[model samples]
Target: MYLDYFPYPSLRLHQDRMLDAVYDTVSSGDHGIIMIDAPTGTGKTSSISAALAARPGKIVVAVRTVSQIDIYIDEISRIWSKTRHKPEIAYMVGKQKICPLEREFRGESVYAGCARLREWSRNYVSSRIAKGSSSIYDPASDSMPEEEPGYRTFCPHYLKSREGFELNGAVHFRRSGRALDVVESLKKRPISPSQLAESCQGICPYEIMSLYAKDADIVIMNYSHLFSPDFQDIIFQWLEMDSEKVTLIIDEAHNLGDAVRDMNSRILSMRMIDLAETEVEKFEGTLGQARLDESRERASWRREGIRIIRLLLPRLKKFLESKQQRMAEGEALLDADLFRSFIYADLDDIEEALSNFSDVAVAVADLNLAEGDRENLQGEIQPSLALVLLFLNDIERAEKDDSYQSKIAVSGSGGKRQARLEVNNIDPAANIRRITDNINATIMLSGTFSPLEAYELYLLGVENRAKKLSLPNPFPRENRLILGTRKATTQLEVREDADNREEISGHIRSLIE
Candidate 1:
């Protein structure tokens, strides 16, 4: 059965065993987790053949990097050409990579800029429809007014992409024939994000990939698309599929633990505080003009909120400076309560102050965007104040959770010294299990999961529910060479020493000779 979808006419040694294990685990649905520890020559990408043979629904493959995405795309394309088994395939990267407006929206996050442009596009279309001037499908409906600032206010690509789709009250796309044609063209072959962006001249490449993914049998994406909860929610919603119905494949499973830890961590730096202070000062000058239509009482409250942020900035800088003086050039544990107390000493209610700060940060960001001065919008687009709030919020959330550790690290030399506050996640099992427990089945592939029990029990938290398969190197003993050295040590403490370095170089020289 697996051979039906397998791209090559033959499988490598032990490749059949790996394929059968995946097939049985997926088909039986008794065990929802499987770990494949196959060495370099094992033909691991062919595991998709077994997955497709067993499951009839969508398969979401998570890769560690952008380059890994091409292997799957190439394999699937080969499958289509060789076996005549064509499964619709699609891939997505972060919006920041494919968004055309990223350069125009300077310091703004692609996410925020995309949202604003989409809103403007929708409003423009709705207004045109209301006046009976054009329908959603009309080409002219996507055109900007002769007198209006088109690119500044709305994205032409976004408007053109949505020409054939009417958004329901729930925001689901009710696509027409034109939209279907676009999706069909995308399915003619598997395209990388860069290729997709290049081909999509006047339309939003992200949206086009999204539209195709809704109907794709297999979708390839980065690790964050599945591991990060926010990205997971957006991707699943865009695909219009439930977690229970989707089968997930994690490529390079060995790196998952570190990836999860990185995703949950947050950082705040002295430089961010300095930029935020500048943002607040500029925002205060424009507050009067920005809030003219608001009630006097509300405007006064906004002003007070701005003042609080301005005062807090210097205090934050001072705190970091003090910590820098006491600590060496390394990291030290920070007491969450002590940090909170020091930062919030002037506020009567800590929660309310945080809430007010969040509100002011968002207001300042929106005001900066509304001013129509992209050149001066430096950090206002992403708003360092918002980042500060996020860092503090994470510290608060992890206060009682032992799985998280808060630390302050001082780096660089005397004149270039910089201090940063960070909240690090020590355990990744909980986050990993969060996704594994929801999906129909999870197949983790890696070339380095040696001592398989470590990954099965500890890293993946799938001890009882997982079927483990470890394959030996596929190449013959006579065809390969392996060598090692015990004379040289690359340990951090001694690796930089002159004798140790010379010893390592000597070994390399002997090998070359």
Candidate 2:
């Protein structure tokens, strides 16, 4: 039924079966999760054609990396050109990549700087609209207003994007303006994030792409776009569609488990602690020079908070050092209780102390952005204090959960030795389910899902509910070679034996010859 949407004039071997499996699972009334293990030559991208043909609501194809997005774009372009079936398509990349001010910010400060600029731009545009002036600020013709005394800078692209939009309560785009024209143009073709960023010379690329994604039939995004809770919220809000109405297609699904675990894990390193100390000291040095009485009071409170954090950092470092001394140059399970007790011992009220430190961290981040310090902007600035708080918070949350394992890893040797606290996620099933359970239907495609049952049960946690399809190799037997041997074994126990090593080496040599 969906063959009309397929790009090619004819389907390759086993392609129809793969496409039928996707169609059946998605078009079914109930929510479904299907894992497809299509071999390398099976034309896996065509699964997108099957999804489109299903007419599933708002198909979202999430790839492992930004580079992988191009494959889908090429396939969709083919569908449009050959079949004349043009579905509205939009793709998103991380803000850091598409931010117009990326060159100006120079480092990890770009995100903080972007946030600061957007806040300023929103306030500036609001004031202008209130004063009966044009909300849109033209960069080419109109000179930018001087920066407000306290504010460092404004983003003209962001300001321009605010045009014809109601921001009083909920953001509602006005349909009868140049914004509509831009949306229509974007819908005409699948534009990559870089091309979108370039075409949006005066408007915010992120904002425009988000707007395009809202009405798009298909949105291509990164894995983080769906798995990271914070980003997931933003993308869902932009789509303006219920999760139950969204059909998710995860490309290269083999990476999902690792990606989810990495997302859930928290790491606290000595380098982070040192940077947090620098931020606190720098912010504290500027405290007494502030103006208003209210401002002074706030500064005084922030100073007290930083003082507590300053005292806490050394203790935390000592804890990590002590753990390092106990372990060899490798990882060992950590006692969450021991770490928790150490933290509690330092503060009378653990929650209050954490809250104070969090407030101070925010203030320091703002101060650093305002100052635009050359040293701070040179690298990604993760407030070490924040990392400490997050690690502690994760430990608290994982107290009863066996899926999370707290560990300390010692790396390098003697003088160069480094130890870090980690709350590792051993099982990503719960996290993955949180997503798959809510969506209408999910179709996961990968070339490496050989033990498909393992992914169905462990990684996705969709055991009984999921549909599994493993397509045979499309290439003919004579055209390809497959070989195996039991003579050489690389098992840890026997691999080091002289005969075993020589046999393994001989196998490799024979294959090469």
Task: State every prediction's TM-score relative to the real structure.
Answer: 0.78, 0.77
**For candidate 2, what is the lDDT?**
0.74
Q: Write the per-residue lDDT of candidate 2 for residues 310-374, one digit (tens) a residue.
A: 77888888998887677788998787788778866857787787788888777766554233211
Candidate 1 wrong stretches, greater than 4 Å: 95-156, 164-180, 274-311, 361-383, 483-513
lDDT of 1 by residue, 204-306 (tens): 7777777777789998887777766435555677578777777888898988888888877877888778777777766766765667447778776576677
Candidate 1 positional error at 198, Å: 4.3
RMSD of 2: 7.6
lDDT of each: 0.75, 0.74
Highest TM-score scorer:
1
Each candidate: how many clashes?
0, 0
* Residue 31 of model 1, lDDT score: 30
Q: Could you give me the TM-score of model 1 versus the true structure?
A: 0.78
